[model samples]
Target: MNEPDVAVDEALPAPRPMPHGLDPDGLTVGVEEEFLLVNARTRRVASQAPSVLAAAADRLPGLRPELTRFQLEVATATCRTAEELHRQLRTARGTLTAVAREHGLRLAATGSPVLGRVTPPPLTDHPRYEALIGQYGALADALSLCGYHVHVGMPGREYAVQVSNHLRPWLPVLLAISANSPFWDERDTGHASWRYLLWSRWPSAGPPPRFASPAHYDSAVRTLLHTGAALDAGMTYWDIRLSAVHPTIEVRVCDAPATVDEALLLALLTRALVATALAATEPAPAIPQHALRAALWRSARDGLEGMGVDAVEREVLPMRELTQRLVEHARPALEATGDLAVCTELLDAVLRRNSGAARQRRAFCRRQRLTDVVDLLTAQTAGATALT
Candidate 1:
């Protein structure tokens, strides 16, 4: 994408006032998880989102359409506690699974299609989506990606922007843990999270710049908009960003995890990370852009089973070490929120399995059939069984 020569002083809305006496540990958190609707018999993505969504119309506001007709998204209501968030996610997943079954489909929470042909799925019926296809042809066609997005409440946009800086170094680690897209189009992609690589094709996607201030963030966004790299703030697609429609810092680093327990782990750790950032007295780490990108690639390529780069130190280390560092860094906040024990248990479970990617690979290796992978995803998505 070409960078447009635009004035940096574009008028933008003033930042809102920071809330007084805000408690970081008590901040509300929510998640929006995307899933692929799969044909139960064929084990292929089914473009029945329109009919399925209509069947689930009563679950509106919580359940919504995605960029592709094969994709559906479910969002949790703002939750004050980790357990409450877990309940919401479980209920949402269960309800959606039932609704999809009613339409002769199954909800697969894997990040990408496991057993389908690599054909362009139908675009959702919306003018904005049509415009996207018109603007970015092939990129729009390969939009069958699913993600687990976490929103951590912030005091204001300015604060959220600052929190994003603190988030950059840890983003890769989170991606590694939630890496679930091992197979695509009936073949292993070799990369754990193929979704991340596919998503990076977007002009405005991936790690965001480290802004010095809220104005700097706005200036950078204005440049993307002016250059048409991004259609609007909502399209910025940064791994971390100030939510365009909510008073929260949204983290988009993770692919949709295989199970609700995995999703809860991401949410709890993310909230704790945000709380840690809020309490920090030191400035955000000054990791270089190249180092950050390298770290992300390493995470996506290896998931939690290989070496990872410590962006801050610019040194490669075992991914397990990086994950430990992440938990340690966020320990105080985790304890403050009374989620440390549950987070520890979830983290232990994930590590034992290696990652969602590893679990999928294990399933595939068992029968050497992608249908097994699809079955695993379908079963897990419906809360019928776990990867173990």
Candidate 2:
């Protein structure tokens, strides 16, 4: 009889190599979609994240985190190409819907839906969430509002910050493109993108100065940390900025886009923005911060409705004219990604619809009820193209 001893410790598998790309070996597209859970029957915000995730835990393809008890987030897997990213998003959304249905919960993608009153929910017991709420208080909870943050990995932090800075001029344009939030706190705010205005209330919100370099951006972040303007880089919540953790420029300005098509339009524009900005080797334009802030307000107030933004000329113009000029400016980038058709289709869609904000407003107006808004928002779950 021979007794062979088995080792107590097993050999761990080697880490997989990151994907190769022109941007970086690790360069890829990632998305963070914050969603609000609603009662399928009542259409009110549901505190069912834990229950739903528990039931669907086996199916989620990528990281799924609950921001609040009622809010769930699903991230797209890192992919070298947009097509792959789209696939990942589709898979994730499908999984969420399947899981939510298991728990009789409906998930909705919206910056702010009109039917519910949002007060800070107890921070989920997770340490990061608890600490985040502890440090930031109700602000973290107030962000119960949903948003989709698209991150495009860059070659270096320096390049990312440069892109971030270069992006400041176009930040409002980005915001305008995805301005889908029309209601706040169960009431019509008479604005297309009330979420944008709501988000800017935080101390560290909005576009920051164009950094001289990554080092310069770091210095400013460090200074803010020391002075207590922000507890950490994450709290800055800039419309666009270099992520302290990920080597990517995080475009935080866009509202919750209605569908995958809308998300990709914004994503391509984001990547093209970085490409165009890098190619120009230009310093951040010398635009007034106040003017930028005001422009954002105008976009939110009248997403392609009121006068258009004239950043350089500093005058009001037609929204359609501004939209066309913005498209033309982004033409080269669109062509490079082969997303020109998609972008045009989506752009025309945005122009025709009243923005997500406008659509929400109209939906609420027709029904003349907040509860109806909830039903409409619930249909926005999964993907915009998906038949509810």
| Best model number under TM-score | 1
Q: What lDDT is reached at residue 81 by model 2?
A: 67
Worst 10 residues of 1 by lDDT: 4-13
* Local accuracy of candidate 2 as per-residue lDDT tens digits, 1-388: 2222212232212222222445331246688887778887777788778887677667775546565777778777776666787787778777787778778777777887555657766446687677766676767746666777878877777667666656776777777777778777777787778888877877788767655555667776676677766777777777877777777778888877766666777777777676666555335565667887888888888886666577656777767677777778767766776767877887787777656666676677785887776666666656644321
- The pairs that clash in candidate 1 are none
In order, candidate lDDTs are: 0.87, 0.70
RMSD of each: 3.9, 11.5
Q: RMSD of candidate 2 to the true fold?
A: 11.5
- Clash number for each model: 0, 2
**For candidate 1, what is the TM-score?**
0.94
Global CA lDDT of candidate 1, please?
A: 0.87
TM-score per model over all chains: 0.94, 0.87
| lDDT at position 143, candidate 2 | 67
Which segments of model 2 are wrong by more than 4 Å? 1-27, 127-141, 383-388
lDDT tens readout by residue for model 1, 254-293 = 9999999999999999999988887776667777777899
